[model samples]
Target: MTMVSDLFNSREIALGVWLMIAIIAVLFGKSTRSGFGGVLKALFVWNLMSWLAGMAVYISAFIYLFYRIGLWTPDLLKDTVFYILFSATVSMFKANKISEDKHFFLEMLKDNLKAGILLEFLIGQYTFDLWVELLIVPAAVLLAGMQAFAANDAKYAAVNKLINSIWFISGGFVIYHVVDSVIQHFHELLSLGVLRQILLVPNLTLVFIPFLYVLSLRMVYEEQFIMLSFKLRDKKLLRFSKRQAILKFNTDLRGLKRWVNRWNLSHPQTREEILVTIDAFKTQQYLEKAPPVVLPQQGWSPYVAKDWLPDEKLKPAFYDPAYEEKWSARSGNLKLDKDWSGNGITYSVTGTRLAADHLELRLAAYESKKLDELHAIFKERVALLYKNATGVEAPLKLTNAISRKKNIHFRQGIYFISLEKSIWGNITEGYDLIFTISTKND
Candidate 1:
């Protein structure tokens, strides 16, 4: 068996080749078969260009850095321009669209490739760095995975037809893509009568390519996954905090209503004034389940499962790991947790839609305290990351841009809350809670 050092080192060709195949298998799953054939064809032109440029860069950069400071060769120019082009292209894609999908294409090639689905794939082939060559096998498989997983909301979901074909034909070995890439280089060097040491450089580079690519992509993938998880968790916590805050504000309405009732009782003739307060607080509001999200919730799949949490309370005795629940409750019909006196709102599957993607409420008769509580909770989330209003520099009036659609109103607490969650999406459904929070008639 190869030693562990041999496995990690890029210096060995066999190790590198084995690593490449292994990584490709992980990234593509079943798509490394015939699907790769199509990918190879599309990538053929790009690979030829990359080979021309990268070889030139390697030679030129090596020479310049070690020896000549002047006499820039055509290879230098080719490599420099290619690097600039690729960097610019990658930056443009990143800035152009916010990739909302949490799952990465892992494309190191396609956004789920058949030939080309996204324009970025076509652009990437022409513009990416030659170092990407090492990642070719893995990304090719990832492309298949991306095609498979892009639309899937679940873990390890099935891919569509075109991708299946790619998967079918992509299996067996790493030799095909490697051989395809290097055949010309090998042939050219033999014809040129290059020295033995120099001739092997390209092959050496090829060996190291997969190792480097996998390492780099793995780093990026991990960083991205961590960051994405943080944002999602932050958003959820921000919302939860909002719910807790509502309890505090609920008390305010109670005190106000009591004063109003007392005033009306003392005058007995000031009935109209008391009536106005009641009308405002007791008004019935209805929110029908947003048609788009008219489905039930399933559940969020967070990394820290419920079983992992410690049973005892947190203490200053030791640092505790951050906790996250894939779920929570609000006592409204269509709210993320509850539906009140109405049809309530529900978020769509994508969790992108706003306006209707919220639970509705009805603030009817003496429920001002509950309304205040709800509003207060909403306010907290709004203040925090929801509107992103509270932190750092103030943003424009785009507060609603990020707020979880927490649609609420009043007809008392019997409102319908529909929760097609903004992040987890209909992961919590089939439960209901109704409660009456007594408030002094204001």
Candidate 2:
């Protein structure tokens, strides 16, 4: 009876719960078949940093609270001071090392530290509340692990589904415990001798609401992928351009095989149609858009290239002034024009559409070594415009530099930006930019 009582004590139960969670993370919470070795390494390193930081924060809080309440004896004060110094020393050293390296593992330490501090503070401040220490801490740790795995894109579809399943189940458990905790705390304060059963509507509503919202978003992504896959299977993809369709539908061979096999099983006559569709997609030859294998010779000129075109002949694109003229002449009131500053830089803008869509712009910089700096300035301008337009407090704006490809795609506001580096290796020849406005209806 004494052993059982000791085993179920708050601290012991908390430790046991965390141990079980760590085991689960190593065994089933893995995102990839690459194995748990890397994840475990990251988890241990981050968790140790977290533990030290949390210890420093919580120990300081404990010392402050005890001293203020006139509960601090010399032994308690000495132990607190010792822990604070030790934790601070270890934390500072680890933080400095992480700053110096700046790897993903180091980046994850901040998240782990935040979670650990919150859990440890709750546990240390409310030491008698075994539910907070044992139940809440484990749930928080598992949620953080699953979130990190998904956020980092270290994903397998099966693992993702399993993680969400666990999320739903754990959410239910958390709701139950929270209600029990609230009831117990209420009884302690009110001195209630006995309690009747309580309604769970409020607890369930508060805890499970966010889970339902996120699950809806997950379902939306799955539906999108499924619809795209079906279109590829059916050979009826009108809405997406060839390039857009390819980018959206492309997957690894194993993934593609799984998709195809399942699709074939459901629609038996789709075998021939799917093969034909895939072959058609493969024959489209998107490889021609890739950058050159070897860098062109220093003196080589695109204008003097052996086989393509005469210097006078320009490719037909949104860049051609004549093509711009024809497009602008149409009924919906669109105009495309270029602004050339005297300094070898040009900015192109397409006229606004009535529906308020994403507009694409083409920019060219010639005979300049500050191409990167120029693009950075343009991206910053675009980010500001997006912020003002949307009225979002904190918007994520990023630019991806392309070296081995001709086209890049991303969205800011309604504007879908596609940057094409047609003559990138030799910037003397200049590059092209294209922006398309995605309409509200689309």
Best by TM-score: 2
- Residue-level lDDT of model 1, residues 1-442, one tens digit each, is 3564332323233335757877687557666656766766765687345644554455445546533533333333432344335532343234212232222334422322234332221232122233444555466767866875644543334555556666566532333544444554556545322332232223223332343333333333333434334433455543442333233223233323232333322332233433443343332111111122222222111111111112211101111112231111122222323324232321111111111112211222122223444433433432332111111421332234224333322222221222122222233322222111111111
* C-alpha lDDT (0 to 100) for residue 359 of candidate 2: 31
Give the range of the ten consecutive residues with the poorest summed lDDT in model 1. 312-321
* Model 2 weakest lDDT span, ten residues long: 192-201
Model 2, CA-based lDDT = 0.40
List where candidate 2 sits over 4 angstroms from the true fold.
1-65, 68-147, 150-162, 185-442
TM-score of 1: 0.21
Segments in model 1 whose C-alpha atoms lie over 4 Å from true places? 1-72, 88-162, 168-442
TM-score of each: 0.21, 0.26
lDDT of 2 by residue, 246-317 (tens): 354452322333333344333433445545545543432232233133222221111112111111111111
